[model samples]
Target: MVPPTTGPTHHLGKSEIEYYAMLAKTEVQHYSGTNIELGTACGKYFRVCTLSITDPGDSDIIRSLESA
Candidate 1:
């Protein structure tokens, strides 16, 4: 989860730590949008530096992203 401006290092240190931890556990997908954009997509009101898609449910997001 690399932001556009800050690259992999966002201002919030916890985000970076979570990113590494998530990376070690599973496949991490790179979001091309900024943190703000990601937050909007997730229906949040703030920046989201990292998002964990634990269960995609019925969505085709996993397949689409993997194909891309």
Candidate 2:
């Protein structure tokens, strides 16, 4: 895979967005629906927080919780 880039704020803003993400802690709740993708098998990793990833190609939008 090609490596990500680091450039000026606007030109390489997409990479910056990937660095931020939403925290889903196991203590709370997490479900992909009736078909839980990760499954209840998540271990201590379950106790930890999971980060929500966004498609890095969408540079047209601003970076926020969903975009992060």
- RMSD after CA superposition, every candidate: 4.5, 15.6
Name the regions of candidate 2 deviating beyond 4 angstroms.
Answer: 1-11, 22-68
- lDDT by residue for model 2 over 3-48, one digit each (tens)? 2222322434434443432232212122222222232322232321
Worst 10 residues of 1 by lDDT: 1-10
The C-alpha TM-scores of every prediction are 0.59, 0.16
For candidate 2, report its TM-score.
0.16
Judged by whole-model lDDT over C-alpha atoms, candidate 2 comes out at: 0.29
Best by lDDT: 1
Model 1 segments more than 4 A misplaced: 1-8, 11-25
